[model samples]
Target: MKNTRIKNIIFDLGDVILNIDVPVASQSFAELSGREQSEILAIFNENEIFRQFETGSMDEAGFRNFIREILEFDDLSDEAIDTAWNSLLLDLPPERVELLKNLGTQYRLFLLSNTSSIHITQVNKILEASTGVKKLQDLFETVFLSYEMGVMKPDPLIYQKVLAQAGIKADETLFLDDNYDNIQAAAKLGIEVIHVQKPTTILEYLKDYAV
Candidate 1:
């Protein structure tokens, strides 16, 4: 039977369920770029490259090429680029994985993420290398990626797409994401939201939903 009150739950990947070390990535990029971390950080917000990659407009190789072009540093290899780009993904706590499995037995659980092919590949490799983490897709009934879908969060279409795919309604769905803009976007569309913030986690925020 479908859960009438909260029939479905959609989760974001980075920082919400998965741990990301932005500082580590920043430092890595700084070293590679020969610039300050602050400068590298600024590029993330101002550069449309992120959107390009996340929306499938750019491939992993193209991204590396763009990085070299923008940085004007052509000597970095593909391995170097993947390492620096993936530095932000730290670890996925076992508790979160366990929680997702538990939640799946009750509400319909879904994973909606803004990610690219290179990053997802690296995330799985990191997890497998460190703790032998299970495949992320296996834990959820559906995995909606921005790169695969060609749409990202904070855009109303993504949320609509998830609902459409799941055959669910916004009011009966709960969405959790680390980014405030994403939370706002879902909430504005009448989806329940938990802004998964620092010092708290998906396990804690969704404590009420855990069976």
Candidate 2:
């Protein structure tokens, strides 16, 4: 039932490739906001400021300002904000990077991530520091950031855009994401999906895929 003709692969960034600890970020925000982590996370869950930043409606400076206004942390320095915002980002293991680099030669690789500028800055630092690989973009045919695309995952537009831009049929492409909602969205559009989970790494899961 698998599509052997699949020529393109779309990958998600956080949790799938890079580790993210949301609790660490929540704790950082709670300390800054003088609120419980639960309250801060609740606000984050419903916050338009976050959506706007991720969708490129706001830049890093604007996002910092919005955080100050929303969290009532008027004294929060830009450095502090960037640090706390990037708290959730963890290491990008060298193995993952090697796998991606190898896969690039065998398939058309693409990266799709819902992220902000501050986080991306840290992500790049981690990648370079961990593997001396300065950029993942070099391995990808094209990298699609939600911020750059002005649309986040689970949205039809982002999926449609990638498919159209790559000139690939949805059924002939595979998408890998950590979030079920994101996978579901792409699946609805006819893309094959692998729900990348914690116990299984991307490389392990794809060992038999398209082989």
Give Cα-based local distance difference scores for all models. 0.86, 0.87
RMSD of each: 2.5, 1.6
The candidate that wins on lDDT is 2
lDDT per residue for candidate 1 within 1-211, as digits (tens), equals: 2335898899999998789976887689789989998887777667787799999999888999988877778998999988998888887887788788788998899999999998898877765665566567777888899999999999999999999988999999999898999999999999988888898998788887887
lDDT score for residue 211 of model 2: 42
Quote each prediction's TM-score.
Answer: 0.92, 0.94
Model 2 misplaced regions, further than 4 Å: 1-3, 209-211
Q: In terms of TM-score, which candidate is strongest?
A: 2
Instruction: Give the range where candidate 2 is weakest over 10 consecutive residues by summed lDDT.
Output: 202-211
| Model 2 CA lDDT for position 111 | 92
